[model samples]
Target: MCGTHGDHGRTVPPAGEGLRIVVVGKGGVGKSTLSALLARQLSRRGLGVVAVDADEQRNLAATLGVDLATVESIVPVSEDADYVEEKTGARPGGGASGMLRLNPDTSDLVDRLSVPAPDGVRLVVMGGVLRSGGGCLCPETALIAAAVAGMRLHDDDVVVMDTHAGVEHFGRALARGFDTAIVVVEPTFNAVQVGVESARMAAELGIDTLHLAINRSRSAADVERVLAYVDRLGGFQFCSTTVLPFDEVVLTCEPEVGTLMDGSPLADATVGLADGVLAGNRRPAGSVT
Candidate 1:
């Protein structure tokens, strides 16, 4: 069912076209915040940006103040549930009759998973039956990856993906679709370790454009220290680390803090990060020197 070859050649993303930036790291490293910040910054610039929540945790929608009931509630693609009838030639909600039908076309499946988001950016929630068994390593993961890649072919302003921590979703095919992989880390042993591991995995998967974003940094010195650690590991492309101050505003914002667009410090840092991404100054893995 897989292995349909398309034009896979690398083309320079057109001017003003939305960039696909994937935020990845261990949980609690503020990946969703970073994603929200990116979306807010880009949108403020009048660019239509979509924030994709590939993580099953479903925090991206909440962070942006979007209430999503189910995966289908967001994704526009045809789901396996939608196929229960077509494959069986049964009506919707028909149990036994739908059980004996053939699966729907892969193209049709991709079409149904695309859900629209507010603003100009679209949101595709990758949470469904596929993520239930193991994770993004399954066939469902491959389908979503294809759909995302297809979306990137359009001239959208930006597509920022908030991935699950620990790089569990860094499947070989999925990683290839991302223009840049921004690994968010805190100034701690575990976060740093995860950053190092994520960089290595991304490189191994042939995701050449890997960069680092240091989150929750108390000071500039702290950001530098984390960069030094990543350099020592020799696997990450270190961009200018964004020093997100430990702000009470971010704390109080809780799960519904979509105010990163309000010219806050966190918003400023995210804008800088987005600028760096758009400029293609993303540091190469192991480019800390």
Candidate 2:
């Protein structure tokens, strides 16, 4: 059954209030992988989790071993083109307007497109929005935004969104739906730049809760450097400074869509990070000690 919405339009589960955690960062920084790991860890703890893949690339579901066939079968929220036109007031072939017009029955489409993971984890893959002549909001984008809002209202145990690397997803109405935002960055100049831009966008969007996750590190020193950069950027704090070791196992296991919780080194780090983030502890590395 479809969940109900709150006064604020966020989805909230009937049993317990869920956390909306979003993973954002530059490309090739393992943001998607970290998102999958976080979902696996939370599910292992017996919490109901829904992982939303807002990226057009559509890799989050695949990483968790969810088949495309199953994903394409979930029912979406809505399918009324006229309703979309009324809500967004987008033109038929305008840029954002045209995009918003595509797939008017978004809720129904997403419900049909969602795939289920092994341990009761749900995967919603939102394809990219194509810009036409007008600046119409993409229907997929609108659907995700509405879904996030609906999830917040229902209080679904945990809503984890794996966003695209470029911060493009953060610009539209969807950015308003997230409660907490986590930026993933590697130890590189370009990655840092992306992180900075992401942070700026998060702040601009009035996101009250924000955190940084440092992925793919070789040593403790690398972790520290990433932390230092985050500090220098100012405004953002480190929720969990987890160092994901460069593991060839991740690549080898990709074909199987194995999760980090499969007893791998990366999985351990991811789990630890998820625990700290969920607990609302934003201390620097070793401060808990």
Candidate 3:
């Protein structure tokens, strides 16, 4: 069931279609894992899915199970001097201040730059700009923001953004036009606080369908306990606070070796969370503005 409340005007696309989603939360809260699995699930259903790795870690490709050979040479678009320069005109490397295409036409870059991923999912890597020195933030961030927000996905296409941790990096460009944001949180107070703050920042950036997922959840009681905290926040009730159990399979598997190793409860829970996130996007026929 969707843990949704309030008047979000978002509407779910018909069968064979998907909306945008940005998975974010505290570090080690499983955002990358969820992003990869969710994209894979959508693609397995024959949907067009794009997995955007906007985190500084740039490890999302590995989690999505992209060929290790491909990961070894992967460079984030934000740091790709040629591609970033071709599209934005502001080059990478040396400090790129001055004027920039804050609203560039980045329509074709998504397909051109993304690499072929498993399950028919395409991957786009975008590293963080905040840590790029405040002076270096403008040009890199402008191009990245335009690409993330301006790319128009097909009816059955889903774009999943695995964003950097915390609220410091939630800018308007990346959050715009996305249908939902699932903030993954562990069963702890500090993590929940980060989720709440992220949700708040995402809302301010115009993303309305905010939700939570309990990563590495231990039991039904633990899941419910987290739900209680989400409820106390009032405005930020999760769309469906799905639980990803702490399974041994995930713990033991080497990330570089494989993803979703055979069968994983965490993977199963992620698939359900994807469905719930989509369910929350559906508005009554007449409710959409």
Candidate 1's TM-score reads: 0.75
Query: Per-residue CA lDDT of candidate 3, range 6-43, in tens?
Result: 44444455444357788889888888877887888878
* Runs off by more than 4 Å, candidate 1: 1-12, 15-18, 67-80, 83-119, 128-139, 282-289
Q: What is candidate 1's lDDT per residue for 41-60, written digit by digit as tens?
A: 67767776767777777777
* Residue lDDT tens for model 2, 104-183: 33334334445678567777765555211123355544544555555532344777888777677765566655656777
- Candidate 3 Cα deviation (angstroms), residue 8: 5.5
Which residue pairs clash within candidate 3? 3-239, 17-156
Can you rank all candidates by TM-score, best first?
3, 2, 1
Q: TM-score winner between 1 and 2, please give it.
A: 2
User: How well does each candidate superpose onto the true structure, as a TM-score?
Assistant: 0.75, 0.76, 0.86
Q: What is each predicted model's overall lDDT from 0 to 1?
A: 0.61, 0.62, 0.72
After TM-score superposition, the amount by which residue 107's alpha carbon in candidate 2 deviates from its true location, in angstroms, is 7.9
* Most lDDT-accurate candidate: 3
Q: State in Å the error of residue 289, model 3.
A: 29
